[model samples]
Target: MLSCVVLWSGRRGSRELPRLRPRVAPTSLTRVDFTELVPEPIAFLGQAAYIQLEAFENLARAVATAPSLGAKEGLSAAAGVALRKHHDLIAELRRSGVEPVEVMAPFAPATDRFREASVGADWYELLLGIYVTTGMLDGFFARLSEGLPNELADRVRRILAEEGASQVLRHELERAIAEQPGLADRLALWGRSLVGDTLLVARSALRAAEPSGRIDEDVEPVFTELIADHTRRMDALGLTA
Candidate 1:
């Protein structure tokens, strides 16, 4: 299975955070020939770009109201990363000779609804929400890219790999949990609640790619891996998934 290491600080305690380097299991859908499952190229690019823009917007808002200077700085850096990715994706769209705005417009409503439904009630909840949702979607997009032409696939993979914010968010969440042991139960619940909506966003992307608008049963293993990766992430945080 394809794997990546997630490194975080701190040590294990009874229901407490641990210094972790958990391996994320492969969540790729390429185990079967899935070229036909790839979405229309323009649709894929537009949705990917818009999602990054949304992430940038959310992080920027969090930076504005962050409780501490450290948190503000951390979130601001992550926002910059998201913004740059958005700009890069837009450039890719322009290279394909489409107006970036118009292409992205079609996806706004669905993505917006996903964001609203997953929005957190407070700072900690918001941070975990972003971490979980973005992590899953980024992995999903990377997997989908495998079916794209080689050049586009390479570019998309590179952009997704520049996920510095994931580390920052993980660190922030771990710090919060380490400081407030009582928060583990609540955040654990919040993390679990996010998977259904996040998976819906992912499935919708695949459904849009299919002419019949129905996902294949073969896709089940892909999602199973996604959920496993998600469970590992929550486990790293010493939370029950």
Candidate 2:
């Protein structure tokens, strides 16, 4: 597919945020589709992406209204920044053929997957992960930017008060496993797949980012490292079980 990314802001004050990090390998992207992009990652961690987006936005607004954490603002404002940049991340990824998983469009359906499945939703930690991951992605994007754009970074810090969605999900999942006992194996296996698939697909983002703009080589190594570290954590937690 040959196309140009047109980021036409419908409103003013719509700054052109940081571009994507780098190019992904075409070979890596060849067999993937939008659905495969977001698997039922480790007890459905992929679902957390959308939830966290919401978490940060809520926090941002709160901060704007009342001073908190000694910053004179809440987390909502910060999430706004990340949400705005997420648009760019999608553009950059799609331009090079890394389409987002469409089923997550509203970011609500995934929540239903675990809403009443006996797992208490750890809203807190997932919220935190949302903030942290936003920061990680934002920082990587900024460094890979033409001028090291930090728009995403700002939003991430703003949502700093909250815990990551992953942590919450992990805790809940752990509890579920502890009680079920028999389900542990499945969860652990699923967790491994999530980690594996994430790395495999991640390459496409790298190649996708390459042609349209210049991304720091440093960005990929860092991103890869983060994913690996995250995967290790999940593995230790037995997410697949």
Candidate 3:
């Protein structure tokens, strides 16, 4: 049985952007320079789009491999819901005059590295990754998006609203754990590994996003929130942090 409610209660609240904005060069500035203007938000959106795209594709594969029609249909339905939001995010990027490809370029290494490392993981780990890791990242971006311009933030909220996949994923993992009590130990360890790997990749992406040394002060608070949220998520799934 899941022991924690913090996952539902401790969601990062939406925060509006300050009225006094930083003076940025034009939005039409060069790709390299544009990152300097709004590095984390842009990078966050870009990485979000890339990760969601990959996630839906992976879910589709899982659907295919499912043994029962019931399971396949449930997974498929979740993926279908996710697909619509995925397209919406791409459209929003274009509307914002940002090239999805250009913004996503910098984080390719980290995302790709994560995928490569998980190549041979078992099905439970994959489902748990979707439920825990991806869910947390989605929550993080959704919280940050609240501080963006209204248009961009609305699109991101749409992306974040596609929670069907995570719900289905969480159910599947919980059923597995309930059926096989011993599996919890292994999955708990796997969950920790996933968290560690995710942090490493996130740190690398943060470094790339913030080239200036000034990011030091900003990182600590953001990480404190992330770590706290991560612990909540782990506890919700009956796993130790």
TM-score of each: 0.83, 0.36, 0.73
Candidate 3 per-residue C-alpha lDDT over 110-212 given as tens digits, one digit per residue, 9 for 90 to 100: 6877755543377777777666666656665566566566667676777687666777777777788889878878888776666555555444444535546
- Measured over all alpha carbons after superposition, the RMSD of each candidate to the real structure, in angstroms, is 9.5, 15.2, 11.3
Pairs that collide in candidate 3 are: none
Residue 53 lDDT in model 3?
Answer: 69
**Model 3: residues with Cα > 4 Å off, grouped in runs:** 1-42, 204-214
lDDT of 1 by residue, 1-241 (tens): 1132222111221111211333334454345445656677788889989988888877887798788999999899999998998998899999999999999998899899888776689988888888888888888877887777889989988987786578888888889899996898899889877776777677667766655655655565556666677887787778887
| Model 2 Cα lDDT, one tens digit per residue, 1-241 | 1111112222332323322232452223333122212222211222334444544454454345332353322244454554554454444335435445663464454333322221212332333233333333333333333221244334333333333333433444455567776565654443333332232223323333444333334333434443434544555555421
Which of 2 and 3 is the better model by TM-score?
3
- Best-to-worst order by lDDT is 1, 3, 2
Query: Considering TM-score, where higher is better, how would the candidates rank from best to worst?
Result: 1, 3, 2
Cand. 3 Cα-lDDT: 0.61
CA lDDT for candidate 2: 0.37
Model 1 misplacement above 4 A: 1-36, 210-213
Q: Could you tell me the TM-score of candidate 2?
A: 0.36
